[model samples]
Target: MFFVDTIELSGLGNRSYLAGGARTAVAVDPPRDIDQVLAAAARRGVRISHVVETHLHNDYVSGGLELARISGAVYLVPAAAHVSFERTAVHDGDTVEIDAGLTLRALATPGHTPHHTSYILEDSGMAVAVFTGGSLLIGTVGRPDLVEPRLTKQLARAQHASVHRLAAELADDTTVLPTHGFGSFCSSAQAAGTATTIGREKEVNDALVRDVDTFVADLLAGLEDIPAYYAHMGPVNAAGPAPVDLTPPALADAEDIAARLAAGEWVVDLRSRVAFAEGHLAGSYNFDADGQFATYLAWLVPWGKPVTLLAGSPEQLAAAQRELTRVGIDRPAAAAVGGPASWIREGEEPASFRRATFADLADRRASGDVVVLDVRRDSERADGHVEGSVHIPIHTLHRRLDEVPAGEVWVHCAGGMRAAIAASLLDAAGREVVAVDDGFRSAEEAGLTECGSHGDGGPTA
Candidate 1:
């Protein structure tokens, strides 16, 4: 009896699984890095019988199709798979029997999207492990607003029903193994680090504690703005992502990078947002390397199109390349050999951002003039937050920019990722924005408690 489960954590913190009884294994929600999954399975001496996608993920391109193509395994999806592909679409209650006694039962849990589903493993009488795609997480349920606006209500209804259904049907001890983990933008209430059981989550999940109406309101309130590239990814993934070839083009001199850019290739700046803002290739896309870089680049850079990497150094180029490859942007037109300065000498450059430390933001907040924008998720805000700070949750900042006053506004995240993004958006929108370099934690440590610590990001002053 092989009851062992191997969880592979991708660089971006996505969890893909290889689970089975013995010789047969099932891979779920795999990223574009299929080779890593395969390598792990080979070490365990198990044959990958099926590649499964719980739903059409908007965050990262699924590699299940490509893995199936290369390994001759069956690719499995839900019945709502409207995309044209050679796949086995299972219904809400369909069962995929893996071996003599091992089986996985699909449950239609459509809240994140209309087609989302979850799986329950059955080995003996009842299974205790449920593979929740985005319907349920350790500390929160999936965001209901990812679908259509009208669908948000319906999805909320379905989401509540689905979670309650799981709570009612499954045993309390059932382990919840989810795809999205803590840092990913998929769920706001994702547990900080550890996995949780259904029993524990039922007691703590804020969305579950409230009635459906309150749940809907709470769910929608302060939801982060979906990324710019999220909409562009769904169609591409559904249609089957074009194959990625990692072999870089023949030695084109540093000058050739400009030719590639002029030829319609996009040069993606992989440095921090502040670094790019300071100075970069004028026309390069400002997709920083820190947060969700590969995920965004997949949509921003077309497959097979030339892309030049503008990273910190030669060491960063390989890392940047790997991140790009995760989402299938494996080719490099060429890396900026001489760095950003190389491009500037060629007369092509991009803008950079101005950064302020926690001390700087605190001083500004003390003046009672600067609007403190906390860009963390709503759940994080609810935990505890900086006093008197306006909450926009990063994602919704653009749509609600009018709400933020025109004067100097200090922006920050739990650490610094969302703050950087929010600051960039504000700067692009012609607002005076300063990103707090140290973020909230630093403010607390510095003993600047003008604003009580609410456990959110940092204090306003």
Candidate 2:
């Protein structure tokens, strides 16, 4: 039987895949770092015969072109993508054989993007699975607002129709595999389970169970803020992404790290929130390697500016470098691994901040002047927030620092991860800050924010 190997890009909340049999395979929606796809092929003892993109991705740079070039595989992109690359232009109903028994048939699933296509893998003409790039995600669908704003509703309608088409055509047993929506900003709503079948989705997916009008309305209403880096992904993918270079960047000493920060460049610290809160270089921002490091870092970093990575260990630095490459941040200008002591100069002590819980925040508020900043996105804050916190979505916090009210600025997100990141920014900017390292549900519990008797103290959605 023909087989498929899933390459989960957990950092970006998407997945790439290698599918085929008979010593030949096809790579689907590969990330900019093609080594993973190549390694998968090597493990399976297959030669990559084709590299295909379901669409010109808007969430991350696609590695299809580079993968095809490197492996000497046929590169296939949707015909309507209007990209600057050369290769096979896949259109609806076009079929290509991957191996003797495995064939790929393209179906136009316009919605995620105007040209988005879903590829069905058929073994001896029997449908086994469908690689739904951005269409018909587990519980919801890819957001329709990424493309032209005027066409949002139009695409939402198309998205609803596309999901219906897949459910109606594919067999009940046909496996449904999607590329986005595992906490990726590309999803219209949070994805439901780990894996799903076409039949299972028909029962649970809103697109399948609801009418088109209702589905479109619900999807449009529920969409979250798109990542700032996404504005760059589409054009880069359209022009064809450059090959990723994973060579370790130049090692930065304390002086080099300080110089980069002084030059208005970024010095990112990839460490746990607790470790970062304890002590870190004065100007470095904390983007914990333990959380969605790549997405949040790529979202906030000034594009094209050089970045110096500071991690607690060599392994953490290397892991973060790999994650950054996927979103087209090819190389860190420099890197430093080891404790903050190594990166902090001999004279100046490492800057440290206090981490508090919601209860501590409430107690502090009762005593004196303090500024509470909610760094979550607009949609999240709308649900309910601390009565007097300033709203600044983490992505736009850099330019809007002047707007944050004075007084001891105690910042928080739904959970501690983003709040930690925000606290670093404020601390770096010379503001007295404390990271509220507790869950938002505790807000109501501590009388910080209203909650349902009890909610997941983590970032909901």
Candidate 3:
């Protein structure tokens, strides 16, 4: 008998897997943080015999090489990855036997990347599940634009074919487990569920339902700007990622935090959106320590720049550090764990802004006292935004700050999380900020005039 265990990297919006019969297991698409995988293997009383990479990941650093090295497991990668490390290079149709009555067969499923592959798990001769990585996700296929921009169209077409190939070759009852698209930007479309069967995907997956040309066109047209940190992940993974450092960062005093800030380093406040809006360091940006913290922070901060974390508690600091390390933002310059009152005790005045609901902002706008600032992605804004809101995506706000007109800037996104971050930035820049800490839908419900065509971007809820 064989079983599969899903390890959710919820912060990254991705999943890794462990599958085997009884005595041994194989890890698929593991994260840079290997402790969780090790813990899972230990709990199962199974030795990790092999670690596999479906492709070179572009969203976060991979722990496959380090995990394999520490466990004496065979490291297997697709022959086409062209990685500069020692490993077993596998090709399409290659099979590897595991302990008990299990085997893994590689299938070429290019699209997310040129070397992308999917694995079919079999017990004896019966197909059990397919680990589809980024090729075939829960509801849609992986976005093809993460690679060279010139190859996006080619890859999109290939993605369509690759998904069909899986549908044709795999059994209807076979489970489909994918590594991307849970919430990550790597997914071309929103996933309908976390896990599905081959039969279910065949009946519903958009890539499998549409013609190759239409799939390619829709995919290319839907891609938004990839995160800035993504540009650094591929090269780091190709060379091999260093083992993650989980040690709690050194605590910094008010003077040290002030020096780093003076040198223009990022000081991120990992608190609740509301807490951050109420009070924080004058120059620190707010990326609440929950819900896609790593993704948004990595997207906004420049690559390789030094960063310092400001958290309200020790646990918050640790959680923020763990997420940051997953995206290769290792070794924060320093950390300060306390609320705004602590800093104020050190004689620095804490910064704060007003938190308003969509209805309040609508009333203010009608009175001509507020400038609506929509900080959602262009794709999101295209879906529909508050009418007459100044548009600037959060990721680009640092460079585009000058474009916002002078007024009481009322900042918002699809929801309040991003609005709080933008409000912090605007407040830090000496602009009067009022965070519209409510859902985008509330703007319409509050009778605020709305504009923009409806797009594929889903609702905040």
Weakest ten-residue segment in model 1 by summed lDDT: 452-461
RMSD to true structure for each model, in Å = 5.0, 1.7, 1.5
- What stretches of model 2 exceed 4 Å from their correct place? 451-461
lDDT of 1 by residue, 128-228 (tens): 68888888887787776765678887887788878887777788888888887554556645455567888887898765688888887777774666655
10 residues in a row with least lDDT, candidate 3:
452-461
Q: Which number leads on lDDT?
A: 2
Model 2, range 131-203, lDDT digits (tens) per residue?
9989989988888899889999999999999988999899999998899988888988668788999999989
Evaluate residue 136 in candidate 2 and report its C-alpha lDDT on the 0 to 100 scale. Answer: 85
Which of candidates 1 and 2 is the stronger one according to TM-score?
Answer: 2
lDDT of each: 0.71, 0.89, 0.87
Q: After superposition, how far is residue 33 of candidate 2 from its true place, in Å?
A: 1.3
* Model 3 C-alpha lDDT per residue in residues 1-461, reported as the tens digit of each score: 88799999888989999998789999999998898999999999999999999999999999999999999999999999979899999899999987677999999999999999999998997888999999999989898999898998889889999999999999899999999988888988778976799899889987888888877778888888898889999999999998889898888878888888889999998999888877788888898888788998898888888899999899988888888888999888888888877654465688888998989976786677668888887777776878777889888998899999988888888778888888888887999988887877777778764565444335462
Winner by lDDT between candidate 3 and candidate 1: 3
Clashing pairs in 3: none
Clashing residue pairs in candidate 2 (N, C-alpha, C atoms within 3 angstroms): 443-448, 443-449
Candidate 1 to truth, TM: 0.78
Please report how far candidate 3 places residue 408 from its true position, in Å: 0.7
Q: Which one wins on TM-score?
A: 3
Runs of candidate 1 exceeding 4 Å displacement: 3-13, 249-266, 272-290, 295-307, 313-315, 325-334, 341-343, 346-355, 361-414, 418-435, 441-454, 458-461
